[model samples]
Target chain A: MNIKEYIDTANKKALERMASVQPILIDIELEAKNIIPGMDNKTILHAGPPIEWERMCGPTQGAIAGILVYEGLAADLTEGYEIAASGEIKFDCNHDHDTVGPMTGITSPHQPVFVLEDELTGKKAYCTLNEGRGRVLRFGGWNKEVLDRLNWMKSVLAPTLKKAIKHSDGINIKTIIAESLHMGDEGHNRNRSGSYLFLSELTPHMLDTTNNEIAKEVFLFIKKNADIFHLNLSMPHSKLIADAARDIDYCSLVVAMARNGTDIGIQVSSLGREWFTSPASIVEGLYFPGYSEKDACPDLGDSTISEVIGIGGFAMAASPAIVSFVGGSAREATLRTRRMYEISAGTSSIFTIPSLDFKGTPVGIDIRKVVELDETPLINTGIAHKEAGIGQIGAGLTAAPYDMFKDALKAFGAKYL
Target chain B: MKSNMNDLLSEGPKVINIGLRSFYEASETQGIKVVHIDWKPPAQGDIETIKLLDRLL
Candidate 1:
């Protein structure tokens, strides 16, 4: 098909996929069952293209090492290396359970994940908690403070949010996402607005339905940890909707993309359960003080699923303020999101873009477009350091490796037509 | 009433974070300098200094 015809057909299919969309919320059990949650981790959490992690920039390595220690599977860095080499710890992706997470893609068993369940199709997706900042465990900072914080999230924060959500019969993420975009959040890198919106929704419920003591404590914690505590919820909510778009026969859509620290993988709607993988790409961009690009990890984890389904950076125009967090300009933000239309299947009904004059954000990824147009999916990602202990260094954009798509196409051609 | 932009511009050369993909044409008259900082290897708070040189009239 010609590109326009191809795009039109793809758009129609994407719309259909979106119409069937639903949100799923779930808590993942990271029992060393060979799965890691989130997109960038699923793609190249290891050491190859679409990303090459062996030459990874440093902070990423530190994060991975920290997660190993956190998991208690390794005594130290040396042992972790042996374990990774031995492949004793299987790196399963959270997308396998329809989940996503932030950098380092570390979702351990004890962690509580907010699963967004799309009530329509009964599909469920998961994402871990957003531990309030400063050398977080997921970014490869596994200090005692990080461990303690993770424990607190499991014991305190998760239960409170769960209670609040249950009281409200679950949160309607689409409404919040749309509102946040207008309030200067792109719903990925800049979730400040979304978090406030979430708190606003949960606050009333927490106050009324919850016991006064629990309500007071939850409110205090959320107020203190307001650097977008709801991001974890947003990621899984996106996953829930994205999962509803998965596995249609003859559909060339992308169902999911997620990663563990060791591998990056993508699942196409047509291909169903198969994963297209490349090594995670090392992030290259501006760095914090005393840190350089050298400290960043190759891209790892499922956060990109938001971008794939449109919202993260793809909705950059909707959140011009994001320019401050990820580094770019207002015009660039507008274009980044607009360009996604070249490869997408359709726009979302629930997640509309305010800056684009209320046009819907692009939704549904098409693998056929990836091949026919030679345009891979673009993802805005957080940059973890390359070394085993350093943690997050920065965030930037990374495209899916082209070879994975080419390979998937070759495989599809052999089987379908 | 005072405007937010008026207050913001008065701060002068503040460090702002943004994604690499968000760049576009910036204004020349405002004396605003835009420096591009990469978000890779995300540091705690990385800031870049932008010095805007006047274009020949």
Candidate 2:
């Protein structure tokens, strides 16, 4: 077949695989090593592509140090730094282990992980529970309070969720994602509606399975921080969906977009696991009080998995409230979603935006379209402090550096049609 | 709602371009067709007016 015919066939196969994905929240479990194979005491999985400890940026290094302290491998921040620099710890990408995490995307051996299984493909992906906002380890916060919360999640929250999830066969995440989109959640940076919907589904099971006090506290924690409770669930859900489209020869679909504070990376589906990386761009958007651009680190997170699967920034039209956080008007949010459609290979078979007349959100980021149009994928992300321990300074939007897509396209042409 | 790939592949998928000519041009580049709708916000980008119109509509 010629190049045109070859590309057409590849696109068809990629889109079919994408449409077949059905991600279900199957269970919550303790010990990341148990669910995520190859995870060990010496292994540390982080977001984005692999980088040496010496090359890691402030926030990522900060998070690594925090994980070391939290895991009891190191006594404190100073000791943690020494341990990281000593090269005794093994660092790898989360994607390599069928796991995903938001922000710094640190997955230690001992943390509790939510497991998502694609019903159509029976592929499983894992992500740790959301630590909520400030001083969280994902954003490089390694303080005592951060360690305490991680411990609490392992001891209390994880067990509670495990019991609640076990009571049901599995939670159909696609249904909640669709319903939440209508109720004003883009299923990424803004998950207020999605969080509420998730709690509503699980609260009944929690009530039946757990003691009153425990159930009440879990419900309150979910309710109080309704904005991001669904992030962990969404990350793994996106991972399962995106993974379905991987390894299709000659297809130009973007399967992953992630960033460490130091570098941003993209992996094209047909390229297998090869990453095209560029310098992580500093985000341009609103900042939190007492914080400014000077204090913000470059865009960081594996949360762009949401965008890869066609929600988050790509579904911004569905959540106008996100504009307040990302620094844009409601109309601009709608336009952002529309603009994504221009470069996408197809619309999502699941996630749809209500405001766009219930149209399916754009899906399948085509590198060919991106390079041809000179448009890059837009990612909505949390800004980490340039200093690791300061945690999230703000949330904002940033474009995937055009060079990543250009590089991927170049590699695609060289490897295949 | 699930969108079928066939619909996108079929000829004459009408696009209503709102503001940017670049979007219309981009669609043309992809072998898709477009009809540029020469449109602007009512009341010329006035926030209060737009809010009032939103309520009135």
What is the lDDT for B42 in model 2?
47
Model 1 scores a C-alpha lDDT of: 0.63
Residue A112, model 1: lDDT of 64
Per residue, candidate 2 scores C-alpha lDDT tens digits across A204-259 of 99999999999998888888778998988988888888888888877778999888
Worst 10 residues of 2 chain A by lDDT: A408-417
Tens-digit lDDT track of model 1 for A57-142: 34445554555655676787667656554545445445564556676555555456666667777666666778766678667665
Cα error of candidate 2 at position A292, Å = 1.1
Range of the 10 consecutive residues with the lowest summed lDDT in candidate 1 chain A:
A41-50
Q: Candidate 1: which stretches are off by over 4 Å?
A: A1-14, A24-88, A208-217, A224-227, A259-263, B1-57
lDDT of prediction 2: 0.85
In order, candidate lDDTs are: 0.63, 0.85
